[model samples]
Target: MDPSFRVLLVCTGNICRSAFAERLGRAWVDETLGEGASRLQLSSAGTRAVVGSGMHPDTALVLAGYGADSGNFRARQLTADHLADADLVLTMTRAHRRDVLSLAPRGLGRTFTLREAGALLDFVDGGSERGEGDHAARARGLVAALAEARSRRPAAGDDDVPDPINQPLETHSEAGQLIVDALLPLLRRLAGAS
Candidate 1:
């Protein structure tokens, strides 16, 4: 009986970045585990969500470009329950990360900015695609490895996934592109295909 690794993505408004992360993340999880996506659940929430809003139109377009669908996607507010249930909490920005941590101080070791988490993935060794059991072990190891890496590294400048709400479609597109690029490497490692 393997542990279910729950991953929660957080942003200011769930309509744009978080939804996009959720869609992209699920795809990666599927790519990594195929029918075993249940082994690695992916979801999203916002620090200040509109509660029931659909993804931004541009967000949908970007996801569509990546061959992922955003059909009927709705926003949800971040909650302590979400944090308590997660093994990894990836936020769109340091502020979102801070907010999530504020809500659940215990989650500090599990939460990270998407970029930060992915960037740290590059430094961990032995997370290669050896076997399912190995990949799962590596994935869990990677999370803990990241916590250790975070401790030794000096914090950098703000690395936020730009908010696309209330902005122009072009801005949304750019923001979406940014999110995709930032998460690609992290997602690849998570996919266990790297």
Candidate 2:
């Protein structure tokens, strides 16, 4: 059997975005990679909030809309152990990236934001004109550009998947759609990663 590719999806709370990403990413891996899917480990975590609950209602609804099951998901806190074990860590936002890196084990270099990874995949697939050297260098450039762009943006509200801890059900569903949109391509790339 081939070695499993361990992936960790992260967000501020485990109940929403990260959970959606994890489930979708797993399905993508299964569909695209097939037998290789058994060699892939996909999971989600939160920097804070919803540490022990199932996915938020809205997250479930949006995923259900797309025919993805949310039945096996549960919230978990981000931990150093998760970082240590992951071959790749994909976070939702820049803030979530910082939080995960802060807790990441030393010398661990396989972490990135979902957008950043998407950008790198674009670069690799010839969607962008950038020439690649090392994957690390390419990943860093992608992340830096994303962080710079994020700094100049306005804060995202319910449209941004606001924690959803006390928010309305509609909010969680909105957040789930946002997450699914962001995850689709990244999942495709990871599936193609050999």
Candidate 3:
């Protein structure tokens, strides 16, 4: 099926936002796509720090709130191999995007901030009110919407999900909520396509 869609979620440290996003994204894809979810490969990594650790307690807590399973999640570091294999690389912020691009020059076209990608979907869904007529058409529309949003906000930098490591539980909860909100729609679109 179009050569399996591989996605990589990134952040500064793998313990917090990236880990949460990774699990949430994976869950969303699995729930939405069902059997086809096997075709969608998902993983997460850190740009620095947090190379090999379990997800932060707060991250797990926040994910549990959304009914997402974070029990098996673990921290991992970004690698050239990961970059090479990914079809889409979503970073928590613009800085992480840039760092990923530097690591995998070839991924420039596919790499993007989760917020930017989410914004694109927002523009498409918000503008046409299409109500999911045709999957291909809708996908195209989403891409166009993202491009338009991107054009209007050229200075738009990373809307990276803030790191909640060692921060208050409230901060972790807030960060998880933000991630779940952003990922929900994207997951819907991907699942719809499948």
Top candidate (lDDT): 1
Query: Each model's TM-score, in the order given?
Result: 0.87, 0.72, 0.82
Q: Model 1: per-residue lDDT, tens digit, 89-159?
A: 99998989889989999888888998787667656664443334544565666677778787666576757
Worst 10 residues of 2 by lDDT: 122-131
What's the C-alpha lDDT at position 39 in model 3? 61
Looking at model 3, the pairs that clash are 92-160, 94-158
Top TM-score model: 1
TM-score of 2: 0.72
List candidate 3 stretches off by more than 4 Å. Answer: 124-149
- Backbone clash count, each prediction separately: 0, 1, 2
Worst 10 residues of 1 by lDDT: 126-135
Q: What is the C-alpha lDDT of each candidate?
A: 0.79, 0.65, 0.75
Model 3 lDDT tens row, 50-161: 7668888888888888778887666878999988877667888888999998999877656778877776675555443244654434444444456556655556555778
TM-score of 1: 0.87
Summing lDDT over every window of 10 consecutive residues in candidate 3, give the lowest-scoring window: 134-143
